[model samples]
Target chain A: MTDTILSHDDLTARVSRIFQRAGLSPLQSDAVARTIAAGERDACKSHGIYRIDGCLRTIKAGMVTLDAVPELAPEDGAIVRVAAHGGFSNAAFELGAPELARRAKELGMAALVINDCTHFAALWPEIEALTAHDLAAMAMCPSYSSVAPTGGNEALMGTNPFAFGWPRENTDPYVFDFATSVAARGEIELHRRAGTPLPEGWAVDADGNPTSDPEAALNGAMLPFGGHKGSAIATMIELLAGVMIGDLNSREALDRLGNFTLLPAHGELILAFDPARFSAGREGNAMARAETLFDAITGQGARLPSQRRFAARKRAMAHGITLSAEEIAHLDRLEERGLDAVA
Target chain B: MTDTILSHDDLTARVSRIFQRAGLSPLQSDAVARTIAAGERDACKSHGIYRIDGCLRTIKAGMVTLDAVPELAPEDGAIVRVAAHGGFSNAAFELGAPELARRAKELGMAALVINDCTHFAALWPEIEALTAHDLAAMAMCPSYSSVAPTGGNEALMGTNPFAFGWPRENTDPYVFDFATSVAARGEIELHRRAGTPLPEGWAVDADGNPTSDPEAALNGAMLPFGGHKGSAIATMIELLAGVMIGDLNSREALDRLGNFTLLPAHGELILAFDPARFSAGREGNAMARAETLFDAITGQGARLPSQRRFAARKRAMAHGITLSAEEIAHLDRLEERGLDAVA
Candidate 1:
């Protein structure tokens, strides 16, 4: 069942060709391909090539414009709003991250709200770019709603993932990314498709009753991770990601044929704050202080967060990225169909 | 046997006298008394008179300076550091919140870090004060080591608490405050003293075995809520509240004399940001927008976080702050003991 390894460059080239054949402009195609490849290289398979099929389906459905690009809108202070014009999230993020970080370095902090961008893959890359600029960054995205409020039956909220990155001295940046749900919707979906039972407390049946049946859980709603506290954090994120950005909620977005056309696309809120701005020319010393504290905590043998994935990325890059047999077959099919359409 | 109820005024007067007798200046004693009473009024009994005995013990142990006051040191870009000189947190916060808010309004955001302060009762009052000035505020406090890191047997992290407040248009500001632990240390202590069992998964015994025995749980370590995710968030908060503020880590502080002076001291980080600073000068409309969003979310029937406590405070104030019979007896004991010898 295991698949053959694909060199990173080889995979990226193939993905780029597939996007170009699907009618994306070269720049947009390369951005999307690079993003997916980054996810694969970083071991985020769920957001990597696994999403290519969905993106193709959405493009065929005329929900996303293969060649669309976002343009900036007028904003006050360090806030910038981008009109995605139905573009892909990868392209939008490729454009937004550096812009936001640049402004943040000048203004201390900058907030960029991307409106109407289609599904973007892993969020870590965007945060990584900000951290590379020596800025602390936080990003949130409101996807299609699948989670229910604690004690409620209906799916009134999205899994609403949040990611944060902080720079450290002589160490990998501290990066943390997680969905506010008890378990990711993808995990539940995978279990359901495989006809397996879910762990208790991860989800409930459509009637709001706790159920181990993966099918029932998928058809119902996911629970917040830690009862009220998790629910509260999710709620706040929803406000920041959906309401503040003026995007449609999951239910509303789904009602619009699963295409988000709301003003200020429903994708991500990226914020960056330059530590140098706050450190008053002592950036090096401040970073060292952060590293010393981190070492002190982990010196006792506890692993730091995200360190494993970082190590995985380094190891995979050194060796090669592996793909499941099914994933490889899926990509081959996509390549053939895309070539046929272009021919 | 339950003790008699004491009037709010009577309890305040007694606490004030005790603090004064302990060598706190009159103004300092009054500030401490008011903070404790505010906690009682808000029904945070564990942080109110419940801590009076501990405060007395710590004072008698000569670990705190009754007459000490905070000395402020301003940093670049709206950051301020307060050297507490080992003073009570109540007094320190009373002197710090206003200064922090003023500077934040001036600079769009301000961060105040207080080191070497005594334990403050409750965080809600400080959040409320900031929200009243139309500022969104967040506070973090890292206390003594009481919780274990995820998968660790030894207690190495504090229950480090975080509180956030957001201002709405017409309705009261929304506030959230919670300890990072599954339950606060005080709750575990109370359960142990009462010979009660804890809820399952709330804590682990000394050997890192999950246990329901409160005594074992206390001797062991409290679990983070929601497993690894909660633990991760707690770890992040510790970095922000401890490392970023240049304060002590819980374990390091404890090692000093069971005093754990890892950082310069146990520290609290207070951040305030004015919404008006970002809303592009349309003050009234921005407020309206925030309120509309709050109403929309609450209208969905999910209870807003911290709304109940706020309602309780209103009711308590209307009918006069209530004291349990036992609390009344404790106040009487304090009055009879006289402040000097108690200290």
Candidate 2:
């Protein structure tokens, strides 16, 4: 597909319109669109508007309850639960983050768990919500199986993305978002489309044999980043966000959503901690010292976490985000009509 | 130096004796000795009684206050702060874990922040403290710098160990303790002693060139486990434990403990969450579902995290802990005398 440029506004409006046409309430549609737009602005191409069609497919397949309104469970001390009503995670986060932040600020730390949510997008948005409160935050969410455990052949764990945010001193919050795999599935898909070879150990073929062929990898399972270490971290996320939170495990999510060709009904675990409450009389100086760490590392030619994304975000704001011609066409078709043109 | 086998009880008794000779209060010394015994029993030699000499050295150097009694700060909702009074983290955790567990059980979640503590042991013990309470726990601590940021030669980040524990159904808790580096510094030291080669990307030479020579790695700095992903996690630990907790950072720890040949005055963070309160009608089903994950993976030949250590612990309990001849000699030397023979 040939590439093209779209202004941030145009791209977001089209994504929102697509959601509106898909029968999402305006509030839900806007929340989803804003999250996707932020992803694009920060240059996360895979998780941005590119995922609109997948959302539509799940909706068309009668998997997600479009009209379901997320609700917060009665709160306990420093713990808030958001029942996603089988809706997308963005809206659930929108419903729960403010109260979570308030609780954290009042009581030093707080946790929010989102259940029955189809979390198809990136996880940064939920944790980033606490940035407004100058709070430190982290979030984890597990998807259906795609990555294999170390020394095993089958895919039994999700990429299990983790996102962390820090309230900085007068700068944008320092954020680090990563999938536990060597690379995200979308990056591998890009390699497949380009007919490019993958690095060794990136994935294994269907027979559990390591392969550099992107096509073979697409047929098989992706490998975790650092062999056993990455798989262990991914498994922890699955247990914490999936099993412990009373949500379906990876295999269960895969079984239910497999035929629908949509995302699993994933679970998310998020925490926000107030630095002022934790620090010993050094209020915001933690962030200042964090800046010192950044300087110490970056001055030596080492890049700091989220540096690339922040730069891309700055550039996109000044200019515009670029999209593939295929992505543009897909969005146009979805916006102009409904699922009819595609399905 | 040669290896030898020592009985578990004998080792623990001797370790306790050394701590006694080092001027630790009996309660504090017993806590520290029991932790070291557990480590040795579980075959975590680096974080076991091997650290005793370093403890005495720092204490003799007046870096750690032997008379320091850990005190609990006034409770804040679900948060409990343990003032270690410049003592050891084991004693701090020993003093705080029970109250922390009480709060977690009462309020659904609890966090304990140990300030002014010299934590120079495996992180598992603190997280394991919450295991008896059937709590999901995580602990993060930053050590003196031995790992460098990606693309940098200088060591600015600690191995930055993070350990997590999940209460399992009818089994020992699922525990995963890992340094964010490709290999921990101790592993490299082992390779050096064995005159073995290292894997690529494990470490860099003093000139920043990646090398397979274990000696070069020992001389230089260890690399993070998964390049950028591990580095980011390490940096997060540095900020969370070192800066936000108002404790000496990795660099500062390194400088102060350099002559003692001990780990830096690291900061620790531990949190315990009560899954019973968060799970919707699942009660203890969280651990059962977690067992399902373990089965799916273990059936496929993937080893569960901490399986090896649990086996080692079991064997040690049955037979005895095997220490090296050098290690035994060192312990005997310390126990029979004091810091005089060693320092």
Candidate 1 structure quality by residue, lDDT tens digits, A1-343: 7778888888888888887777777877788888888888888777688667666666666677777877776544466666676888777777777777776776566677777777656677788888888888778877666777776656667777778778876667988888889988778878988888899888877887888888888788898898877876776666555654566445555666543322123556787766665444322355666676566547645566778778878977898899889878878778878734321
Q: Write the per-residue lDDT of candidate 1 for residues B23-131, one digit (tens) a residue.
A: 6767667877887877776777766776676676666667778788777766444565667778777777777788888877775566776777776456777888898
Task: Give candidate 2's error at residue A10 in angstroms.
Answer: 4.7
lDDT of 2: 0.82
- For residue B294, give model 1's deviation from the true position in Å: 5.4
- In candidate 1, which residue pairs get closer than 3 Å at backbone N, Cα or C atoms, i.e. clash? A115-A264, A115-A265, A116-A265, B3-B325, B247-B263, B248-B263, B253-B259, B253-B260, B253-B261, B254-B260
What are the candidates' interface root-mean-square deviations? 4.3, 2.3
Instruction: Tell how far residue B235 is off in model 1, in angstroms.
Output: 0.6
Model 2 B-chain TM: 0.91
* Separate DockQ for every predicted complex: 0.26, 0.64
- In order, what fnat does every candidate score? 0.12, 0.70
Q: Which stretches of candidate 2 lie over 4 Å from their true place?
A: A1-10, A282-284, A320-328, B1-10, B190-196, B282-284, B322-327
